[model samples]
Target: MLLTLVLLAAVLAISYLLFVSYYPSFGGDVPEALQTKYASSENYKNGAFINQKDVPEDLGFWETLKIARKFFFTKVPNGVPAENIAVQHLDSIQIADYEGESRLVWFGHSAFLLQTKGKNILIDPMFGEVPAPHPMLGGKRFSKELPIEVEKLPKIDAVIISHDHYDHLDYESILKLKDKVGHFYMPLAVGVHLKAWGVEEGRITELDWWQQATLGDLEFICTPAQHFSGRKLNNRQSTLWSSWVIRSASESIFFSGDSGYGPHFKEIGEKYGPFEFAMMECGQYNESWPDIHMFPEETVQAGVDVRAKAVMPIHWGAFKLALHSWTDPIERAKKKAEALNIPLVAPKIGQAIEINSLLKPNSLWWENL
Candidate 1:
């Protein structure tokens, strides 16, 4: 019995090592140089990035194991789609050689493309079919088809990364997009993974919270999010997480990268109020992890807190990252938006909208599905 147990243990250890070695989602580590740079920031302390407010941290080993077990074994009816979600395709030629037209296209989840002021910006572009490093791991993307093919898309002006989580910062997508990208703007220390994946070091600019970078006439501000970051098991909070503000002379837009309900929304509103539009996080939430992801009602409230003229919901309709029903987020978010009399738009995947006019695609497309 002892000999058999020893052999099984050895095999399990070897399998884990091999899996981490080849999985693209595992990502690269934060190098010493980058860590040193991050240490100088106000957010990084005691060797990890700190949240602005005190939030729940320890879930306890037994409780965590129980939650994980429930997540895997218990099933939420229609947790995945019976049919693939619909997407709107675009022509590649028009995107590349285009006049300055302010338009935004949704690619589902947190990934979207913004074209304005003669610049094309892609934010959190996760196009892969799976969210995990390898196929067999605990990762599956709801929609296999993106609105546009990555290669067929135009060259990216900037790729904004919110954090190092697998769903938001995909590995295969980055590898495919590296050659066509012009530059990447990310939270501090996130470039370490990009450099390891073959992107040139000069192509990435890392920023701390509230630090701003300019591309053309747009000012990109990295703001705080109530979240944690790590690509692997051991490196939680090694990198920073943030929301973003994209501003031009006439228009200002906000992207809530991934955060729970917090006072930072009001703080952001006070600084950059009366935005043209705000893309707010509205999915992957649960009572078990309330501090990290906001409920659908909070989604609408966050929109109000940001002082946006119009709000579009994101972070759902792409992946089954939570136990809630597949259509629950859009359903609940739409209701809250209506009750609050908030101007809300829930665009179909890949549908393009004119940012200036702010006409919401005002329909619950997910209800039938």
Candidate 2:
């Protein structure tokens, strides 16, 4: 009995060490002088600590604990293997060559490669193999490999991140592309995580709601979103979550990071209306967290609220983060878009869509997957 107890304790200690090593925690320390200057301000308190209301009441603590336990122990449904994800082989996509206009190529999930004014920008890049701190815990990435590996990517002028969720901000992907990236833009407290991951402070730029910054000939404006942020249990709402408005001389784009149905969308539309294209979240929704993630129909409404000329649905078809069927988000979104007469673009993995051209209807690719 004594020997068995010793063995169990040793195993538990090793597991704890591994967890700490993999998930490095931060956010306790800020520059004391800077905090003293801004801590007591109303903007610092309310704008920084933006509280999330209307969190759906379906899942209680015990219910969540039960689901989490089952998820940890049960065999994850292997929805589609990496070999099945379609890939379009293109030598290069020249945005500058396309009559000096903007274009977008989705790399899966929420990652997009946007080109405008002879510059390349990557948004919410998550090219890692898994979405969890440990590979054993999270869902697998859909593609066999990234459309372009980190080293093979062209010189990136800027990288814009929406928030620090695992699916959006991957650790390994950031580490691999850190040296190649010229600048990084993200929400206010997310710089702490980047600093923990070894990104130089000089390279990181953090912004609050309504703040705008210039990158090359383009402007990046941080907009509001109805979402919350926390990598761990105790730090909920310690950071800000937001959507982004990307505007160049000729075109404008809105990238809605994960968000629920909120009045902010209409407000943003009134401010930055008639966008050329909008990339909106359209998956991983649940009744228990309805305030954080919009349902499929709500996503369509959000596009209308933003006054986008066209919509490209994202945050689906990559990982099964929710319990619904794999294709439920797209199926529902398609019907709603058609009913509302919203121009929706559902491209295959790694496919590029021109902003001015008409969107083609592809087969239901997720059916076979």
Candidate 3:
């Protein structure tokens, strides 16, 4: 019996290794030459990327067991919407021919199509049904239909990626977008995944935190975020994670790409403020791991720290990634923003808001769901 059990364990271990190795969704690794190039980055450590502040990457064994027990046993009411979320559809012709002032349309989660200075740019465009590599491994998107299908998108000027996480940098979405997108911009080492996935090296540009690049009249700045990154078990922190600052002659916006509340917000505000608008991450948080994702109150504070004229709560109203109620993030964010006397724009998915125009407060659309 002992020998049989050992053999079973060996087979299972080998199978797991082969599964991750053969999976195309697990993504590619940075080559040795790229690693040597990244070694000079202050954020790149002995081998992998490190945050400005030391953030814990893994939970302790006992804590892991405790969380797993709760995750499997403890049920939270309204953790997901009762029915498929409603989407306000977009017109492909309008998007393809837009020559207006800067505008943005949110595609539910952290994805956005920003039309600035006559250029269409996608930020963290994860348009997959499930954020996971496989549909069987994750829940379906809250909405049955996207605002616009990936095939219907116009020619993209660029795509800004914040990290290499499966939720933010989706493999299937990238495959659909590569042909339409002219360029890809991401943090250091992220280009390896794009290259592996068939994007030309000449079309990809990678930058470290605090680095800036220009595309026409717009400036793209890779800024700091208090987060760790990995798509597979062994690749944790192999690629850097960051927020982004996009500025044109008349409009400036900030995207908090999955970050915890940190001093970096203040630093970014000092360097790039006062932003006309900001998209703040405010979802999938737990008290157990407070250092990587922000609570709703922290989300509001981060916006204030960044000196945004107005703020929009993102990273929620789509997938259910945590134990909180589906509406908890937007609800808490509204309350905090009210207390702080800041304008909070919670537009319905696919609604376009002009950047130069006044951002009026949105109606309570999620309350009825």
Candidate 4:
């Protein structure tokens, strides 16, 4: 009986591996040419990208098995929002109706739009129904409606993707927004996937950590983020992950594009701050996977570390990607921000943060659900 079960497990594992290998939604791997081109980079060695600080790639096989047992066997009821999330859906056609030098509209999760100085820039616009390869497998988007459909968006000046995770670099969303966007920016070698997705090579710019690119008067600095990347099994870390520092003539913004607690925040603060606004990652965290995602308190600390005068909490209130209560992220971060006296903003989905004015106040609105 034991031998039969061992054989069955081996077959199932191999079958699952083959399934993902053939899945088109998983996205294309880094091409050999790009990999060779980036071979000299410090982050790219042995044909894969490496994190600056040492961290385990994943829980070892035994620990993973243990977690899998708990995850699959135990029911986690608090993993989802109690109701359809209340969001301030915006009409993109009426963007001129609002007034501000710089405007931001978050579309839940990490997707947001930043319109500044006559430019419409999008960040990690994963507007798909799920963060996984397929909606059927990954569940559904929490909010029934988003700020604006991709077709309704104005001509995008540029689109910046933090990394190629399914939750960040969505396939369908990319397809819809690709033509409307003038340029696409991503971490090193991530263009391999975009190029395959039909985005022209000329329209995409790939950057390593600390690299800078200019779009008209705006300067985009690719800063480091304590994160990892891969779309499929064999391609782990072939592409780099990064935060971004966007600076225009009069204002600068720091976007913590999915990162964990790290000294890099302080380094970035000393180098480019004090920023007018900072978007800090504050959700989808677990104690076992401490190195990749930051808890709420850490998110507030990260804002202070970045010397952000005003902070906006992101990466939550959109999806049930973690086991915590849906509102836990905002609630916990709000408490920490109050204790630290850091200015924190929690704008509803599709609500604009007029960076020109005083930062918006936290409403603790999720409790209403």
Top lDDT: which candidate number?
A: 3
| Cα displacement (Å) at residue 124, model 2 | 0.2
List per-prediction Cα lDDT, in the order shown: 0.87, 0.77, 0.91, 0.85
Alpha-carbon error at 369 in model 3, in Å?
1.3
> How do these models rank on TM-score, best leading?
3, 1, 4, 2
Candidate with the greatest TM-score versus the true structure: 3
Off by over 4 Å in 3: 60-62, 358-361
lDDT of 1 at 170: 87
Off by over 4 Å in 2: 1-18, 21-48, 52-61, 70-83, 90-100
Give each model's clash number: 1, 0, 0, 1
lDDT of 4 at 238: 76
lDDT of 3 by residue, 63-82 (tens): 88898788757788998888
Q: Give me candidate 1's TM-score against the actual structure.
A: 0.95
Q: Model 1 Cα displacement at 273 (Å)?
A: 1.6
Residue-by-residue lDDT tens digits, candidate 1, 1-369: 999999999999888888776765687888777778778999998888988877547677799899889888888998878887877787799788777558898888999999989898999988888777666766566676787788898888889999988888988899889998899999988888898788888999999999999988989999989988887666888888999999999999999999999999999999988798999999999999999899999999999999998888899988888899888887888889889999888888887888866666557678666
Model 2 scores what on Cα lDDT? Answer: 0.77
Q: Extract clashing residue pairs from model 1.
A: 25-133
Better of 1 and 2 by lDDT: 1
TM-score of 2: 0.86
After superposition, candidate 4 runs with Cα above 4 Å error: 1-18, 96-99
